[model samples]
Target: MVDTGSANRRDDRTPVLAVAGIGKSYAEGKQRRTVLADIGFEVARGECVALVGQSGSGKSTLLNLLAGIDKPDTGDVEIMGRSIAAMGEPELTLLRREHIGFIYQFFNLIPTLTVAENLALPLELNRIPSAVRRQRIGDWLAKVGLDGREGAFPDELSGGEQQRVAIARAIIHEPALVLADEPTGNLDGRTGNVVLQLLAHLFRDQGRTLILVTHSRAVSEVADRILALDNGRLTHDTEALSW
Candidate 1:
């Protein structure tokens, strides 16, 4: 969430993404492994929520389902009241492209594309005017402190810098929801903290919704609410302190 003004925050206060009774399972040879079951939550617009759990828990799976990247075997996901299951690929693609931004722990920049090119990819795909896209690219670059390094390739950047570029790419369109999967998992603690702080600042400053998955308590503490997952179920929900 960016520093949304009071009026903007109020306008975006309604439930933007809702999840209910989501369950997913996959067969492992002859045995079925349940990845998530009956997990339910809602992320309000302009809010930051964290889902924390040990490995094998369903944090990533749940995030994927909510993001419309994966279908749930059972349960319904409603985004701002629309049924996710009812969407076809085109509708889903539109929903994701326009309303959702995803951030991965490992920066997944295109190896061959420069930082600026990567950031503009989504907007260009959506057919935004070049002038608007260029301005947005510039704004994101500035926000992430990479104004002059946009020409650099992902491999030329440090891990933290790479992740920052990833962040810029994610938020350039100002999506209603940002789903982050272990956004800091690949970095050192110090670097990870810096990434987390950047995320926190974005949520606070931009007023976009964030649903982050992390195992670190330090990361979870920044969220307005923390959802703990275990063995494919959500086990805990706590409201953490705000910035």
Candidate 2:
């Protein structure tokens, strides 16, 4: 049976992510606005966790903190066992480049880049050789069901197609952690379902840790654990971890 309550470590592996005493706030003119306060959790390696909450529930804020895109006002975030708070900007950038992948709510594909070019981007940024990049692009295109549309521009493709490209691009380099923010929010029901399945299958097959911020029940259904945030704190966590 699967261990949803704690890290499913094979031996002595560490958790993929650990958020401790996390608190984040913003200034709305004069007073401070607390977006997330004293929130904490750990995501195990190879586990898929769904973060769900009503709109304006600090979900995105928490995700940004996890990705090191935003700093916590009080507390620390650790990814792959490294402290996000301790890293300088250059170090953080390298950490993100080497270990993280992201899928945005709106498919953030560069309009000028073709499907193949977009998928080839992460590999290119990591300085993968041209020949190996080409091979991976071809493979990922087929994996995401866009095999023959490699040269097509973003505008030429449908919403679902663009998202497929996004998914393919995000995982092409096999980052240890993948952060998806409302990945299927813009697609129709059927199309969204297809994309979600692709995400789960590919992540599971590759043994990557996935933390998805979503409101869809269908998305949460696939996760090993479901966490809910309210106002600026974690109000509910199903399957609490023992460690």
Winning model by TM-score: 2
Residue 95, model 2: Cα distance from true site in angstroms = 1.2
Per residue, candidate 2 scores C-alpha lDDT tens digits across 1-243 of 778555545433788899999998899998999999899898988999999999999999999889898899899998878899978889988888879999998999999999999988889889999999999999999888888999999999999999999998889988989999999999999999998998899988888899999999888887878889999889888852411
Instruction: State each model's CA lDDT, in order.
Output: 0.87, 0.89
10 residues in a row with least lDDT, candidate 1: 6-15
- Which tens-of-lDDT digit does each residue in 20-46 have in candidate 1? 888999999999999998888877778
Lowest lDDT sum, 10 consecutive residues, model 2, at 4-13
**TM-scores for candidates 1 onward, in order:** 0.91, 0.92
Please list the residue runs of candidate 1 whose C-alpha ends up more than 4 Å from where it truly belongs after superposition: 1-13
